[model samples]
Target: MLDSLLPPLNEHNLPYPDTIHPIVVHFVIAMVLFAFVCDTVSYFTRNPKLAEVSWWNLVFATVSIFIAVIFGQIEAGLAEPYDAAVSTLNLHSILGWSLSGVLAAVTGWRYVLRLQNKPQLPTPYIVASVALVGLVIAQTYLGDLLVWVYGLHSVPVVEATRGGQL
Candidate 1:
């Protein structure tokens, strides 16, 4: 019936052979980076125009990050990590959840700044934005470890899992 159009399962038994989390999360990362860059550059250049751009980017990023986290949680649950990969997966999951909250809080603060009489971000908000970038970088490293070091969805690992040899 409806399953006629569905793709066959891969070695990992996923209906579609690819990981969905990475594709969505990369967009979240890019949007957050672009937002921070626009904000920082605008702060220094005194270009009010860039503030509008930055605000929109942050808004989109905040919304997109939740989507990324949801997909990440789903994919991670399906990952079936081997022994050595377990810790990295756990840490990445925790940080992914934390980053979603942090991003939402920062976006809320940015909204407050937009509503201010001056319509300018404060120094503390800027500082927090920079810190957010740092946290994102750390999260990126953990993700890399899972994909590169652990090879979570790599074909060989997938095959092993499917064969019940993992």
Candidate 2:
């Protein structure tokens, strides 16, 4: 009997390579955390330039977070996570969407502050920024648990599932 060999593919299988979600999300995570740092530093140092930098970072991060979320949704479906990973994945997905909205709202507030030419960040905004940092940390932890601990979309996981061993 003659037959063609099956082509190799990575876990979360598709013929071509794909890593868009993690790459975009990580960039967004860095941008948001750095923005918070700049915001806090400017608040303490009274440096208008750093505040300006912080504003731009927030604006870009708000936009990028949406992109990250969209790609994450697509990849998450492709991942087809196992039973153990489902709850974590769902939580991460919810948080990812929620964070996008929260970032946009915070960015809008910051835009108002920028327009008003505020001398320093108000305490309320700073407090909210701290909360945002906490949320980001929680989201990061969930993502880490999925990839590092549960091995969602990893090669071995995919192979086992395909082999009906999972």
Candidate 3:
């Protein structure tokens, strides 16, 4: 029955080098973390200069997310489709896209607020940043589960047998 939901695993048809996939994932995760850290710091410091820097960080993050999304789609295509793992990947994708929107909104709001000479961190700014951080945590967990629980890719045992370690 599980087979009905999940495409059978194919070890020979990987979309990219295993090394490449993990590296891209790590890089993308780092980008998101950087954005989250910038957001939090800007919120606490209430420094308009830091907010400006955070806005640039968010722009870089958005660009990185676009690249990450492409890589993720490729990875997903390489994995079994319709399985629980893919389902979780789907959830992660939704949350990731939502986060991009939220980040964009926050950046725009900050820009406008700066233009208006009201550079103080507003209550909504704090609330949105908090929500974005929560979403980042959830998305990170989903990414971990996709690799750790689903066995969609090579496990450590297989890697060791293949004379490699991930």
**C-alpha TM-score for every candidate:** 0.90, 0.91, 0.69
- lDDT by residue for model 2 (1-166), tens: 2225644557666434765877888888898899999999999999999999989989888888999898888778777688889999999999999999998999999999999998899999999999998988999999899889988777887788888877
Clash counts per candidate, in order, are 0, 0, 0
Q: Rank the models by TM-score, top first.
A: 2, 1, 3
Q: What are the lDDT figures for the candidates, one per model?
A: 0.86, 0.86, 0.63
Model 1 lDDT tens row, 66-166: 88888788778778898999999999999999999999999999888888836466799899999999999999999999998888878898788777897
Off by over 4 Å in 2: 1-10
Worst-scoring 10-residue span by lDDT in model 2: 1-10
Clashing pairs in 1: none
- Candidate 2 to native Cα RMSD, angstroms: 4.1
Shift of residue 8 alpha carbon in model 1, Å: 6.6
Candidate 3: residue pairs that collide = none
Model 3: per-residue Cα lDDT over 28-139, one tens digit each = 5576567556656767776667666666666676666666666667766665443345578788778767766766676677567667766466777667767766776787
Best by lDDT: 2
